[model samples]
Target chain A: MSSHSLATRTEKTEPAPARTRRTRNRGWKPRLAPLSILRLLILFGFGIFCLVPLIWLLLTPTKTDAAILGDFPLSFGTFDRLAAAWQHLTAYSGGILFKWMLNSVYYSAGSLVITIVTGLLAGYAMATMRFPGRKTILTLTLLSMVMPATVTVLPLFLEINAVGLTNTAASVILPASFFPFGVYLAFVYFSTSVPKELLEAARLDGCSEFRAFISVVLPIAKPLIGLLAFFSFVANWNNYFLPYVMLSDQDAYNLPVGLGALMAGSPALHPERGGSFLPITRPEVALAGLIVVIPIALLFLIFQRYLVRGILSGSVKS
Target chain B: MTTSRRAAARSSATAWAFTAPYALLLLAFGVAPAVYAIYESFTSAKNPGSLGLDSYAMVLHDFRFWPAIGNVALFMVIWIPVMVCGTILLALLLHERVGRLSSTMRLIFFLPGAVTGSAAVLLWYFMLDPQVSPFAPALHAMGLHNSIDVFTSSHLAPIFALVAFITGVGQWIVVMFGALQGIPEELIESAKLDGAGPFGTALLIKLPLIRKYVIYMMILAFAAALQIFVEPSLFYSITQSGSAWWSLNQLGFAFAFGQGDFAQAATVSVILLVLSAAAALFLVFRTDFFKTEVES
Candidate 1:
């Protein structure tokens, strides 16, 4: 049925090539050809619109508090302010900002490792093992995706506190490790894209299920696993509420919560709190924001091909 | 009979081995806390020693509780359709016009998703603040002169909701664009040749094929919208006067940690969990969302 539809589609699209050829033969230009230029212009305009704020974030760090509000939106302030901002940011609360950045790294990266391993295993199991309650498990995971993390936060906070894990990295990393979306993505990728007959063939060759998954399925699932890791890292890194409610110690604060504290406690802005805040300044806050985003941007740049392929294939199969 | 019994025992052991870790985690973290919260919701908190169904009555009967739900409901009313329609449109545009420019455009849109919640909220705060934002003149021209201060009112929750929607569009657009690109190119070309305009073809062919994805995105958005914390919370903390506009989740957080009312907080969390779980179940079982049967 799909092939018949494909054939008809091909027949309909074939006339377009012939028409273009005929127009070229007559030395005639198609009217719609100029629309491509229009499309490019519109896309470029929108691209600039999207990128300006990010550029503003990058430029904001070089300026002083006064200069940021005074200077043109895109203008770079003196370079010295960058150093000053850095020094102030690091030293503001006795080097707590750096501690927050490290905490962010520990929590996000820690969570990413567990999520990728368990998600891959669960996904592989769902794809390869025809066990009882497979459908039930998959359905439950999907349902979990729709439950708001905020709703779980209060309960989770109480649970973690009761276990004496509050204000610890486990508070953040443990919850993030169980992401159902990653499991679902992996499940869909495995079921639709990975071939089952190949696994059966491997089984006949005396390969155990675990061995076959490691040797065959793992290699095929690399793109998806990479995609999942990048996303999980980014999500955990950017996570605000979980860490906010879980940890109260400034030393335990992740970048988002730390930045929030900095903004709230900035002496210039809120004089009532005294001048003591995170050693970070506004531009330093901007710099720190840039710092947090850099790893994910690098990941996107490095894995662009795999990421796009993973997304496209995953979507279609779903 | 002995062999069959041994095999049954072996299989059961394997099942337990395979499932034990997840089950333990789920029970310890997921199910137990949720169930406890539900129990807490029904119990009274007036006396430290006594616990019965009074907390639920107090929470449900409270004037603030209903408005908090109303604030979130209003947020969803504006947020869901705009995000769904806007993302689909952006995706269609990107898919139809493929080139260096389009790819660059795609990356540009996706960049916002890279911004951590703090930065996104901070940037939007600066943009919406009348004194600091470059867009202030334009906002004033549109009669939104006190735009930044709007966060204080319950009426302006929708505006705060709108900012959240705009900031979040980048990721959803990427998801929708991925789905759009997956539609066999031939299907689109055929529709074009049949004298279908771009909009017409998108509405009839591409949209229908991608309807499931659209629904999934909506469900995800709806779930996330209910969790609107960082934006509204930041706005409230910064302004320090919008406590009345707190969503149930925010209120719960405040009760537990901020106000030191653990029991009340647990009660609120329980209600949110039940509602979200119901929504999740509907999507999973009632809809054909996660079905992989046709693939094989």
Candidate 2:
């Protein structure tokens, strides 16, 4: 909407005689005409604050423990040390680090499919259909959406365990799949973007409810689907607390839980577990940390537009 | 018309069909667990003598409760202002399209949000360690010999708050950056025509335009700060001083997971829900977010 308006304004202003004269009259530009050196420095300073640690995270894995302590924080270590860290990380607990990464993939992918499907169905139903309990459904969705997610962890653990689902992937994937936030996002998105007449036309043409959603609505709703999918996937992937509470089997732990264990002073990462002489070291844990981080960074790099829109959508409502 | 009315009823049934899966989930996970948590908070340990407010009484009187509340209270005071002012300043700077370099700076600033929480905490854990930290040389210059000297009882609060600032600020920057982008360019251009400098435009014009988001950020930041856990939790694992800087969620998490005291844990969760519910209610009434559903 703003882009179209902006294009029109540029069209109108570029041909005006005053536009050129105004630019020509402004004389003597500094290094950055719009900003002073101090302002540029402040922004750069904040940029460095955000970046320095991540640079260290990347570089630390290349070095030995002593070198991590002694060398320049941003300097590279030998490829030999990097290979050794990977070897040690893989050797620990028969390469459970890879197992955790696989488990994370399973949990996040499963939950992503469920979240998108349920959110779209519910959101579309709420937006287009007249039903008896629709208001109550919408109200509860809003209320629960605003409630802090971690608030129910203890009771959810009890609920999951009472039914004998704990320690299974079901424990993590099922609960994480119910994305109230995504449901709300879809509901709001459909209400604002999709015209009522479009769907009504499909109904009047004798299309079945499911057929209409598949044939008519889904084609026009690609962006919304992408947005909801990205949001829920990121949330499920970054999930640490719930899985930490639910899954106790060391072998079943997802990436966050397993990486946390690898870092923990606990017995799981202990050398005694495998009778291996090589204990997990700083570089190994750092490498494992980088492994846990890469997929998410790639996901963000790929689907950044929808992800940014999904996040900023909250700002508008608030 | 009578036949068309029947068609409407049939379609409404179809709508219910579409909503069934999510509705079932909402009941099973959201409603049931919340009700159970409330019930459990008032009872004794399962299969105990009788039901009473014993858990609530115990949690309220626990030595950890008041101090944890005070600690998070102190955190809220520090975190909220930094979140508000810092996000505004950083976002305003980014909104100014200062050549092609601004885009690179934006990505650099935003990359931290992509970094995992565990990694960020691990980095800070080492960053604050005096002996092996990257800041060690500067720390030596200052004559602070160790983590203990730096994270002493009096200094622990700011240290925790600072870690939060470093990690938490990026997401808000991204949000406020989006908010700033919504302001019309004409205003900035007109301000330039009126001889307003960048600072004046940001302070006077742009700031007033995004006042709604400023308040929104304050409320949301307060909610986030109240639930502070990960940084302190990780720190405590190594330092054994988790109790000294017990944020509310950390304290409750310890009681729940560490000690296996579910009733006290549920009480803390319930208190958080009530507080969050009040904030949610305020938002619903203040903005017409709910009204849009009815109108549509």
Candidate 3:
């Protein structure tokens, strides 16, 4: 993909001289028409359409319950209400929100580290080493990649329960670290992006397979590794049902599960909870939801280029 | 420099080193639980339960099982086309237009996808709720006053399913855009030079090239949709009625986990597994989905 862009760059650079020559020979000026006008219009319209909900989410925190329901959807209600909502959400249930955020960070960071390391090692082996049953391993990894995490969540929960680790951080993090998709992404990246002759030359120069992988292949695989880490982190952070079912203790809940619990505890939503805003409310649920999305949105803004490349590179083949 | 002795020694030593961790983890988390679930599916017992196929029988015999299947079938029928068509259209739009604004537009369209499952669901829940949404007036104009009322037995599954589709379009759009960007510009230019209009170029040149990607998107969408959870689970909180589990899926999950019937939950999971695996296998073997040509 980079090579394709490089070719385009060279073409653009070379075309500058040719354009001047053509104009001189023809003794005429060329029209400088702007391309992509229609595309830009459509994309801009779609971008606003896509952002409406998020904009609404951001504006929502500022409103009291009445203002949230009665006022304009996009307008801010009061700055005080935003702080009030945050305070209420944090103080609700003995400040369980902090615990949930910590749990999310632990789960996402722990799994991300393991996934990147394992994916790199496993992907490097598959790409470079001609091991027995390597094909079988690749096929199994692909199959696992396509299997929905939800389908396996039940069995996995039970397994974790059997091991007496259901409510612990490990239950979520351990399963999340074994992302088959990341492994396959790394494998394809290493195979296609990294040249094989480089590794062979390094091996012939007395580097062991492991050393060759570390020194020669690792540098090339760095961009892909970063991409995989980000993907893994986002996936683990956003995970819901696994932790929802596995962790019963409120203190162990991650943001998604915590938000769900807030919804469940909302009095207007749940009649059993006696429909009051003393404990939790719709605005608090909204606030929690906003908090859950903020980190991911921040990460995306920071690494937008790599995220796009990672996803395209990972799935374009299939 | 004796190769045979070195090869034998290396093979023996490295065999465990290479396969041990993956094999152990796979068995402990993947294979063992799957086998145990299947085994438990056939049996009926308490927490420290007995072994047999009664659980499967009970699950199949339950009135909810078939209905859940029907609900998922209905969801797939509605979901797959919307996702595929919307993604393709959005991707085409992004690829045709190249500018700074277009780049920013692509980023915006891609933002919702970056937000994970729970956040998207919650966002949509608020968006769809009649009380808080900007769309309330429009819905009211259309004579639908109560948004939550739309989640009746008849419309509940479909509405939530549509919500799921809308929230998920971001990722699909990104995927389709990537495929669109890969089409050689020369092909498009030549088609234009041949007097083919934009619609004709899209139909003849672009759509055909990205047909594999469309199928890929469909299979993936189907697999993901098969395991619909958060929306319905959230809906349960609003609807409080026992019949909230009106959808076969909600009923299955409610029976298995909510009602302490692990065997039945395992059965439902197994059924989901089969459907997803079938879709996956169809993509892998029946199509050239993953086959890559060697770049010359």
Candidate 4:
């Protein structure tokens, strides 16, 4: 029997009329069913929900505070207004906004380095090696992945304070490097994606396991590395509570804490707080939010290709 | 025999060497602070050296404690399942049509996550206001005429749930879509050959295949939601409608920074840690999350 008839045979258990309907609708251009239309509408609604606020945000910096309150929410103002907003934002506290951006870079980069090195090596060992405490380590990593950063912030502050390291950049970077999620991601990737036979073949070719990992494994793990780096950088860069409690000096603050402090001082966001002489109005605040958002969005776009392939090996066979 | 034994010993040594740095970090940052938190929870300022349960009693007795728990419970109830279901459904839709349009939609969904932490709360503060929000028409239609109407205590749960879902569901879509892609094509082809339609294939084959991933997402999302701090804290700052102690972490912050009661703070932290640990450990151990070997 032909495959088409066999397929129909498999569908014989269904009611007779439904089978004829299915066969009749089996052509390439199936009619647009109600379900397909509903799916399209739902997806279009999702698109609008996600994009509208971002579009609003992108336009806010271009407009004046008065325009932001008065004009159409999606309308754009002028480049002159955007430049003015940037000028007012940077002029606050002697360009502290730029300093906060730099501080964010330093802390995020430092932690990213540590997270990648330790997470990659440990994940490789757990996936490929026969170690005594591997299961315990893996379980602990899973638990730690879900543990709230707030739960540890106070205790970590106390620990760092005891070591006389509070208010230092190390206070943030050191703790942030303990990224159990990145390690877990790497573990999942290595165990599922990398074939054991490849490593074994390398071993038989007179390659030390460590040498093989450095040579053969590292080359193929580029996408995983990118995925790990992107996640670690985002988490460290956007982290607020840890740095908020750890760093007391204003000069040491990262973007989130700095912007928060700036907002607290502004009368626009906090109406109860009286206005200051600083020119940080609604436009300037929106500009600051954009400053904090642009880096991660750029990174996401650049590394997204690697992201899809990074987890693509979820069920790959050896 | 001697060579193989020596090789085994050498390989074991290599494994330990590679693993030591991360182990030490976990010990220092993860285990050490938790141990210190336990110790601090028992030691109070009234009796500096003596260990007691007074701090725990103090935290448990606070009137704000239970309300905070209830608020978080309500938020989680509204947030987690909606976020999970929305993520899976959106991912399946995106998987249905693989083209430039779907890729662009994916990018749009993930865009909100870029403005995370306090910035996200800040953005949503503006976005929910009927006066300036792009959704002003919708807000007015919903009978929220101003910020006052927008931020009532009764409305905070859904508002925060929407915010969290918007910012979070995108990343999981990427993840779930990847999980869908990981299903071997032959299995799907065979199911198709059995005359299964798209909906049946999704429900019967794809959903079951990604069950473990969904469970994993739920556990982690639950643990994260249990300690909802940034949304409530930032919102409280702007609105001042609710008590400052609106969530567990906020309460803990009040004890630690606001009142300098480290003991009480540590007690709260310990309670949160235990709750999260119990939930996580129970789920992780119950599932195949730690299974090193994949059958495929």
* Winning model by TM-score: 2
Q: Give the Cα error of residue A315 in candidate 3, in Å.
A: 2.3
TM-score of 1: 0.87
- Count of clashing residue pairs in every prediction: 6, 0, 5, 0
Q: Pick the candidate with the highest lDDT.
A: 4
Give candidate 3 misplaced runs (Cα > 4 Å).
Answer: A1-42, A268-279, B8-20, B46-52, B241-252, B292-296
Query: CA shift at B1, candidate 4, in angstroms?
Result: 7.3
Could you give candidate 2's per-residue lDDT for residues B64-114 as a string of tens digits? 889988888887787777767888888887665433455466667667666
Candidate 1 chain B worst ten-residue window by lDDT? B287-296
State the lDDT of candidate 3 residue by residue for B1-296, as single tens digits: 68987885674345436444554555565566677767767667553456766777777788767776677778778878877777788777655544444457667877777555667667776766677777777667766666546456666566656676666777676667667666776788789679775678888999999998888888888888788777766766655432535544455568666887777777777777778889877876677645441111
Cα deviation in Å at residue A15, candidate 3?
14
* Per-model TM-score (chain A alone): 0.82, 0.86, 0.84, 0.84
Q: Indicate the residue-level lDDT of A86 in model 3.
A: 88
For candidate 4, what is the DockQ-based docking class?
A: acceptable
Q: Residue A155 error for model 3, in Å?
A: 1.2
Per-residue error (Å), model 2, residue A74: 0.9
- Model 3 over residues A1-318: C-alpha lDDT tens digits? 442243234225434434453354245323312233555566667677778888898888888777877888999878788888889989988898999999999999998888887777777667656556666667766667777777788878766877899888888888877787787777777777777778779968989666777788888887888888888888888898888878889899999888877776666344344546474566777788899999888988998877766666556642
Model 1 backbone overlap count: 6
